[model samples]
Target: MPERLTILVVDDDQDFLGDFEVIGRDFFELHTADSGEKALEMLKEEEPDAVVLDLRLGSGIDGLETLKRIRETWPDLPVIMVTEHADVDTAVKAMKQGAFHYMSKHPNIKTLHAIIQKELGSVRWKNLCLEEIRKQYGEMIGRSAPMKEIYRLIARVATVPLNVLVLGESGTGKELVAREIHARSGRAGHPFVAINCAAIPPALFESEVFGHERGAFTHAVSRKTGKIEMADKGTLFLDEINSLDPDLQAKLLRVLDDKAITRVGGNEVKRVDVRVICASNQDLEKSVAEGSFREDLFHRVNGIQIVVPPLRERAEDIPELTRYFSRRIQMKTGRAGPVFSGEAIEALQTYHWPGNVRELMNVVERASVMAAGREVTVQDLKLASRSGKSQGFFQELLFLPYKEARQKLFSRFKSVYLSELIQRNQGNISKAARQAGISRPGLYRMMENTDE
Candidate 1:
């Protein structure tokens, strides 16, 4: 497929927009805005490869003001200015304000295309250099292949502090990933505020995030700082971000774009400087497609995507993780550290950790209390080794290593389960994922690997 590079044309001329749409249809995807204010809004959504702007706008904000905001927010963006014969001087002013090039109202379409191509070429090289600088492993623990890949991605995206959308299963330490990024960043000294979006009540969500003035409400007797305000000069980690109230989703996006927030029941807009990193167990793209999540807000937060693989894929790290968590827990509790037997470690590795690292930590802590003589044996490590109800599989599981038997029996079970599920939902992966309480991508992976 030809690359669908987007080009945004900002002008009040309906005829001109229609002309470009027809002209650029073959080579690119075209988006249009009638006013400067709308253009900026569209820019956030469309994220065009390049912009064709009119020097003189109709109303709200003129081209100059729009250009200024774009330059401030997305400085490297290339914007070509178009003007009428009477507005040539204004076009020159637009150039001085960081316009890529200025042209007549009826500029040659070929020249405009060439300018867009040139800008795209420059943007690619700029992003390439940025990617090279962003590749470094932080304090994340894990030497597994999958984990090394995650570290690579973390380093790749850490250079410029772009808004990130972290995706992982529950108990996969999403917050730790956020903290690692912040710790390696320039804002390490600043507060790293985090809130589970699902934990906040819907009625108090707004006040909790944006604060409330003293006596602003019936219960508000004291002034309090909001998460956005507290996270200024730092990072805000929103866990289970898909659970944010629909009403607050739009409000959050506006704050992110404006870099300012007005407290609930207050009129003053306080400027904030915070990098937002959000995590979701749910598939946000599916949520957006289902209309439960705002598509615009999704795009705003997904500047960089990092998907943390589930522990089952990185079982090689279990023993190391076990030892690390053990030492840390021992230091905190001053208890005798339990020695994990080779059998115990193999038991942990063999089990499919549905709850991932967090679950493993809980098991290790429990084993510390349950162990006899500071030695964690196979009996002490009561790991869950069952996948699904396959006749004779549980008895057979006891005899064979989990990984060896997983292919033949579990594949059958998963294939039957997913086949029934997909059929029940009429082949809708999103609905099947929700019904099975797993991520859509995970469900798809199972279906791809299964043979039933």
Candidate 2:
């Protein structure tokens, strides 16, 4: 069997610690520490993903003292504190210290399981990505310019363990970038936890991030572990990080600085070791300046910034991207794919795609689905209207002499008038006349003269 994550359970009660061991033995290699001194000794060799510590550990150097030392030596360790009934004040104080979470006596086993899994899962993900890359790619993909730049940056700073900020538009594959960095870094095979800040609601953000003890508050049906604890000794990818609230931002900064986190509703300082990689569509700098985000947090996260260029900025990659999409679409749809006509390619090249590669992929996928013949036509391209005019808006003018620009404009208006009339009447002319703000005879005369 694979080597499981090491977990330390520290409590004065040997019976309670033994129970925890039985519950977690299947998933982790359990270690028990009865006192603060013992816990510190265990920590030196086994940097655990989680530490279950009791608030009252006999008499000398209590759980709180052990937590402080843990935070001092390994600030990024995830710790969970156990408390007695009505120990809310102490719990709150433990939270202020850096406990990832806290739970009361007779805590829910299911909640404990969930918290352990969340943290353990993050570790598994980081390991899988790095191990897969080393075993398959030998090195990360480097043919693409954006990829090469990222590789260079990772190689330079992977050993230092500073925060990395990855900026890109949605669908630009920022998560992949984060993975590549972790794979190349010294912490490869450790946890790689990813969470999208914008995807989670603000109301549940705290519980989603720092976790909550069972019955921490209303609807706190079970205990939950946030991504931070899951990513101990690994990398944490904070996608759409700009959406984090200002208050949460401050809390996150505190964690980054002290390497600790306090779970919601429970108090105990948990130490965690994590490298944060934050990605955002928004300009965090501007947000910081406007007081919508924390500047200190921004600096901490933005230690090394990598901006992923939009697909349009790298126009040279269109053919490659298009071809790749085409092949994938063909495989998925099992369609006899239409070849892009020369004119169709030219039209695509001229287009100023506002939606970037994601849009391009959609266009190709749709075209593949709608192909009726062996070739995709200019008409099939369905380019956005030029200046909001309907189909043939530019084509009609393109054929006209250069000097007839004004005359072409007039022709366009006449076409618009007829189209509008048809639409207003539901394809009936008599009703369209009144709706056109014109007389029936006048409308007929206009239609006759403008007939294509």
Scored by lDDT, the top model is 1
lDDT of 2 at 306: 83
Give a tens-digit lDDT track for model 1, residues 192-272: 998767656677788889999998889898987898899999999988889887888988889999999898888999999
Off-target runs (Cα >4 Å) in candidate 1 are 1-139, 385-452
Residue 420 CA error for candidate 2 (Å)?
A: 31
TM-score of model 2 relative to the true fold? 0.53
For candidate 2, lDDT tens digit of each residue in 1-452?
43465678888887887777777676677888878888876675557778888888896798887887677545557788887643778888888888878898567766765786686676578668756645643423323676557667667766776899988776565676788778778788898888867655577778877899999999999989987998999999998888888887888888899999889988888999899999998798999889998889999999888887766566655554565577678899775576565456556666766555556776777776676775667677676543344456677667879879667777767865575447324466665665456787998888888833
lDDT of each: 0.78, 0.74
For candidate 1, which ten residues in a row score worst on lDDT?
Answer: 384-393
Error of 2 at 218 (Å): 1.6
* Candidate 2 residue-wise lDDT at 137: 34
